[model samples]
Target: MSSTLSRVRAAYARVEAVGRPEIWIDLRPREETEAEARAIDERVAAGERLPLAGRLFAAKGNIDVRGLPTTAGCPAYAYEPAADAPVVARLRAAGALVLGTTNLDQFATGLVGTRSPYGAVRNAIDPSRISGGSSSGSAVAVALGIVDFALGTDTAGSGRIPAAFNGIVGLKPTRGLVPTAGVVPACASIDCVTVFARTLAEAEQALSHAAAGPEHALPPLPRRRPGPWRVAVPPIGQLGELDEGWVAAYEAAVARLTAAGASVRTLDLTPFTEAAAMLYEGAFVAERYTAVGPFVDKLISSGGEGLDPTVAGIITRARDIPAHRLFADQERLADLRARALAELSDADALLLPTAPGHPTLAEVAADPLGANARLGRFTNSTNLFDLAAVAVPAGEVNGLPFGVMLIGPAFTDERLAAIARSLEPRVRLAVLGAHLTGQPLNSQLLAQGAVLDGTTTTAPAYRFHALRTDPPKPGLVHVGGGGAAIETEVWTLPAEGLGRLLASLPRPMTLGTVELADGTTAAGFLCEPDALTDAEDITRYGGWRAFLAGAEDSAPSGVRGTARSAPTHPHAPLGDHPTDE
Candidate 1:
């Protein structure tokens, strides 16, 4: 068996060995999972490039994965979708295999995992603690190493809190970036599909595939360059009810950020906290009522109540809220969004604890609503303001995990990923040809959210050629000897972004590790040996730009193909995805 298939088999074996029924509402059969692994190996052997090849993944019960019933954590409300949710389909297309459908809080109404009838998902590290939810099962699966990453829905703190509790990475992208087509909505308009993984790169790898739908219209945000960034923190007086352990952990995290050159400053958090209150205490609760209200009403009428009392109570109350009150709440939310954005104006991101505390299952059982509300103190405001956020493990407090989230403006998903990676580990890559700055295809780099680190030359081991194509691309072929240093640009892109870029490249080009002049190795663009046939040797020109300049100044010489007509960019903001453009 191939190494990837072997690794997958071991992972599945470990998951089976755990016997944690609460962690999954419905799991794909072990035989089926292994069969898919074998298929992936076959495809890889056949030379197909799958970005997430052999990676195991799970989906929240709310997200439709073909052959599984989507219950949204309420079994009575289950429905079998004909196909996977758009997000899940994207992950599968990129080579990830689904292991199962995980449990969640019923109707995605509660933050504590105990609200589910399937049973509270136990904390991965400490079984006595509440596994944060409604994406509880998804987070736990990732935390337990059963899956590389999982999909969750985030409205309120459904996505972030679970990651915080599980000591994993939670990436809730900007609202509307990932299409919600096949997801059971919590608050349809505000719900965002989220990613949970053991590392930022894993979450980002899934996000890069899932974020942009075929019809996304927003322009790609500029890459966030690494440096001493402005990070906003809430004033000490505003921190509520956090135990000493959590407070110490939070403070130490800030110190680390400061030591790492971040300009950590205190900002008034009143607006943010107030906005969070609007999610439950204000009229915005009506949106939740609208999402599953009919089904809820049917269950009640049929005398088949599957929802937890707390969840049912929360959604039922929305019926009493007047329409004008919801409108008034929306207007109030607009004002709060402005105020919150103002506080973040001078900062690249707002840094806040993902949750004030991690409650035990018994504690949650005693006071579900109160404990859940406390968890949202730092998270509920994000979606209301249409911002992006990444929750990462800060450190453990008294054996329990604590996490912090970095919030940025809408479309700043890539930027948040950058900041998240800076706090963890990352990969660096090299690029030439179309991705160079000011080139026709340079937007692809920005689309992938890569930052230019610096320019350097290869270690005198490659020959450059101008490929005979409509766009007049360049190709670098590594030669054993008699090669010259080739000019190239190095970028620190997320590993997932690099995968997407690799998958999108046309035939005759590939991504391979290249040696830089500084004696360092990085993933860089390369060409198939056969591509050099009938191609113009541009090694003497030094780089793509120089060759292009020479071509522009002089007549088309032998093998120097003329450039084709440039296409108009109507959706320059939407990025280079052929499906969208």
Candidate 2:
């Protein structure tokens, strides 16, 4: 066998031996695979090296791959395509070989993997849990090391949620970053082609290749920026409902950032959550019907029987929405886009949980729609606001993997990726409040490559303050010797990543010594004293999260607090471009 074929076979063998999660469908025949590899061998022999030489990849069955049948999860919906999708053609031309088409939720409707007629994709790390979906097979394929990367689509977090569950990197680029010319429509205006891989570098590489060039031709170079980074995270209380395991995981990630020297601060996520709810609960749902309603209705009329009941039900509901309602949803989405940009205005990127929680397969089966909605809680708003996102595994929770997502405005794919590469290795971190793992900003840490260490407490002498910003900001200050030990955690990061992280800090927020109860100092977030004059001291509750919980019942208006006057502290400077070192 040729070298490329042998490598692909070996990788496939490993996956088969381990009985890895569902990863392939409609695989290329061995002869075809061999012939493709031989073509690459010939090119190399001719001294023509391709950017993705001999790499193996997979495509979600919904995307067209020339000569392959595109089954969008329904046998009746299958069709043979004569041409490759623009993105697929780009990858193939770069010397990548297609291994097979991966499975997904029927028509890419659900986040839980069970909706597929092809059998539910099990979590790569645990068989009992559900792999996040509709990119289920794509995520598992990479997590199992069966392929270098895979293509999936994200209309409402199908691409990202699965990546979080499978312990891999899932890149959901800005809506149009990668051409969707050949992809089956889910919600045409918001659909995005996504990439999945074992590492951020690999996923980013694939994303850059797919998104290269002008709107039509593949560009010669990838848009990349290097150096210091500023990442905004959701303040406490705004993190949404999260299980304890996720909370611990998130806190640990934040601590890792402090140790790495990257500044982690809280921002308001109200606008994001507001926007996210609109995707499914508002007129956006009708877009799905607009794309395939006729086909579905025809199938129903013809007595066709393969459609997933849930998917059919969702599409049928879309028909109930009126034209005016659709227009109103569009206007609301526009308003949210403006608000989201303002909320995320200061930082280089926004960090949040990839999902609020991980439910078991049984739990999902019992309440598929509800469970699926929860999985997309943090992801749905991304495409609506035209943001780029990357979901990376944070660590495990009770033997199941946990993940976080990093989000940035349109075309900020490279910037979010650079930050994810830095955070990947630092799994364990300690946080005192709302930014904990599984929390809103936890995704920020996960995207940066952090893993959860564990949960603990801090020494009593320090005080935690909640700054009055829209989403809320936290300031940890070292008080004189009389304080009580506060609860905390510790996360570890690669030594090389810390420097790049430290340089991204905004003013007033600085990395400094945080005394633990054991007389040990760990890297934790601290702010300048001058900035705390108007801040609310919530040290008695020990963390910003606890304070927010108590105040939740009496929560003030969404527009209650004024944005803090541009930071006066010299240490936490902002405005450094991602392209600047």
Candidate 3:
């Protein structure tokens, strides 16, 4: 077997060993797989190469892939298209083999993966929990290593929530970045084709292959210069219904960015939240109806034989919306979009929780609409206001994964990706501090591209100290000569890349050579002694984690109340997803 096939077969073996068969609706037939392998073999013989040569991928059933039936999770609505969606065609042209269509929430109306006739897509980490939807299968497929990457569609939180739940990267490109010419639409004007992958590099690789090109010509995307990116976080008052665990996760995520030398600040999200509400509660429901009205009507007329009840209910709600109401919603949305644009006019990107909280399958089924609405709390407004987003898995909270999303204005997709690439944490750093997993600032390291280099402790002589600042920062200043051995871990970053990163540091913090207990020197963060005069020293608490533990103990119950609850009608201020002639 070729190396790619060997790898794929190995991955498949693991999948079979796990006995998680529902992760895919179907797989490419053996003949098709062998044919693709042979084609790659021939290319190698001919000395021709492609970016995605021999890579395997799956598409959400809502996106047409020629011979696969486009089900949108409703067999009654299935259609066999003669051609692939533009995005799918591009990937295949780049030498990616389409594995087959995967499952989704029926009609892409729900966020919980179980709202389909097909079996629920279980979380890769914990099957009892949800694999978020309607991109559920897509995320699960990648998380389980079934495919290198997969194609999904994001209408509200379909693309992002699933990625967050499954601990993968979901890149929801700017609206129109990947044409939606052949995908089954949920909200046509707001629909976005998304990619799910195990790593940021893999996700970007998929994006680069699928991004915009003309029907007849492919022009390179415009390149831009990089600098210290200004990232905006929603003011604490705007964070709705987040638990202590998620709050810690977000704080840690921010510290990572700050440590990476990026400027992080808070901004009001009233305008953005208002715009998000209109997506479902406002007239956008009409757009969903418009896209599949005939199919839905026929399905209903035929006694709802193949339609998922939840989807049928959601689409049927559209029948009552009046044209005048839609116009009013449009006017409202225009004003909200303007305000949101004004708020974000200066920042390079905005960051927020991928979802306020993750709900279980039972919670979703018991109150499908409310549960799904909550998942889209921060996501619905993106396309309505014309923005691109990348959801990066930050870390876990109480064994559940927590994610943070970075968003940018439309067409700034590439820049946003670059920024995310820089912020992802490294593994080497996590091992050095006894911080390990679930520690404060650990997520920050991960955000910066730190992968775990396995665990180890400090050498025979070293001391650790926690410097007090408003948010509290960590310092490892060596006391020299007779200092005791400290327990710590090590993380690695590309040398040239680390230098470029260190050069961007701001005041009060500096990168310096530090002596480990083992008498080895490594680059680590240090605070100028003068800067610590007013800072509280918590070295007795050991590393950042111990300090954070105490902070959590003293944290007030009302601190979480500080975040604004997502308004019931998030899109109320913004009107709806815009429809064009």
Candidate 4:
């Protein structure tokens, strides 16, 4: 079989194994999708350079996929679309085959997946929990690994909440970055075409392909700082009644960002919360009525056969919102946007829990509207303020996935991606002695393809010691009180490389997270408490290089530790260590 054929077959098998029938509302026939993939393989064989060649994707039901009927989760409301939506067409043109159209909340109205006639889309990780909505199925499909990436729409958290629930990456580009021409808009002004995938790079890749449609590109926001990025996080009190576990998960994610080299500042999230309320409470919701008030009214009058009661209530209620009230809401939103923007003026992005909490199916069933509203706490205001966002899985809580989102002002999509990339699995190593430049073990790091990030010092809470080894080595130990800052170098490499380096590590030295003077932490060398028993305390020397220099100055001419005067190598004046010492 051809590569595309093989991949398509494997995907079909995985889809069947997942057994979540609600994930897809409309599936293109297996033969038809395979035919499309086969054509792409043929084109590649004929020398085409399709970026998404052989990749598979699913479009949310609200998004037209040419062959599938656009059902915004209500059969009576669905229609035969004349063509693929602009975003969908772009991905297809890039050689991505559409697997089908996925289920979602009716008319993309609620953040809870239960608001769908097709069926409630259950969480991929915990079936008894809500999967989030209105981009519900698209997020789960990606999370389940059924598709390489999937398309969803974001307007008041539809895109991000689902990704958070499913433990995947959901990237919401600037409002107009990806055209929504053929989508059944929840609110035209706020609707954004988004992509969900298993990694930041995959989501970014899909956005790059989808955004290249018919000239919708905008200038990206410039980075804020020249050194380590600055990220703002909301104060815990402002996060509502978030579960302790979720809050701890959010804090841990922020710490990871800090440990990966970001300066974090506590931010007041009041402006953001106030703006988010306007999405469903203020006249801004009138846009939903404007989008499909007539059809919903027709259904309501005929006993609302196809309309979700909650969705109908929300849409119908906004029908009589005075035009002046909308203008007032717009003005208020402008004020909040100004405040939120000011708070983020010097930061690359704002990081927060993707949702205040994860609700189980029973909780959502008992209080659908309330549960849905809570899920949008950190997501709704994003579109209202015209910000770009990327939601990513941030470890798990109680075996269920937890997530954090990075939100930035409009046109900061690329910058958000860069910040999110820090959350990936790469590891940073802090080398204090043997692994420093010009040192004996420096070759091992270079051999593993590690790159020297920069030179720095440990926090003033570590003691430096000289281990009594064949070739003396230094050991770093955390001493809560009487420690002093010690010189060190930080190097970055893939996680696999770090594991390989650890495999051959000698006795007395082990790896642990080292606190740096700048408040960041990195994996570095440390000695066992027992190894410190007979080790010489070299704390006063401040560093191995300085101690070696002092020893050379006072030693006899033939002393083993003695070396010629520092070499002309400008990279290291004193030389962290002599290669043969």
> Could you give candidate 3's per-residue lDDT for residues 1-581 as a string of tens digits?
56445545655676678676666666667666766767765675587655566567889989998877888888877888999999999988777777778889988887888878788878888887889999888889888867778999998878999999988899998887788889999998889999998777567667877883654232354453466778898877698888668998988888877777788877889988887788889887888888887788887987888777877878888978999999999999999989888878778889889898887767777888888888888998998888889998787899877898999888777677767765565423313332245543343333233444433444434444555543345655566665444334566643432543355454556676655544566666665666756555554544455455775223221111211111111000000111000
Error of 2 at 89 (Å): 0.8
Q: How many clashes does each candidate structure show, in the order listed?
A: 1, 41, 41, 0
Measured against the true structure, the TM-scores of the candidates, in listed sequence, are 0.74, 0.71, 0.73, 0.75
Candidate 1 steric clashes: 1
Q: lDDT of all predictions, in order shown?
A: 0.80, 0.74, 0.72, 0.82
State the displacement of the C-alpha of residue 36, model 3, in Å, after optimal TM-score superposition: 1.4
lDDT of 1 by residue, 287-404 (tens): 8888988778778788856777788888888878998998899899999889999998878888888998888899998888888898899999999999989998887888788898
CA RMSD of all predictions: 9.5, 17.9, 16.0, 12.0
Q: After superposition, how far is residue 357 of candidate 2 from its true place, in Å?
A: 1.0
Deviating ranges (above 4 Å) for candidate 3: 212-227, 427-581
Regions more than 4 Å wrong, model 1: 212-214, 217-227, 425-581
Model 2: weakest 10-residue lDDT segment is 572-581
Candidate that scores best on lDDT = 4
TM-score of decoy 2: 0.71
- Rank list by lDDT: 4, 1, 2, 3
Give the C-alpha lDDT of model 3: 0.72
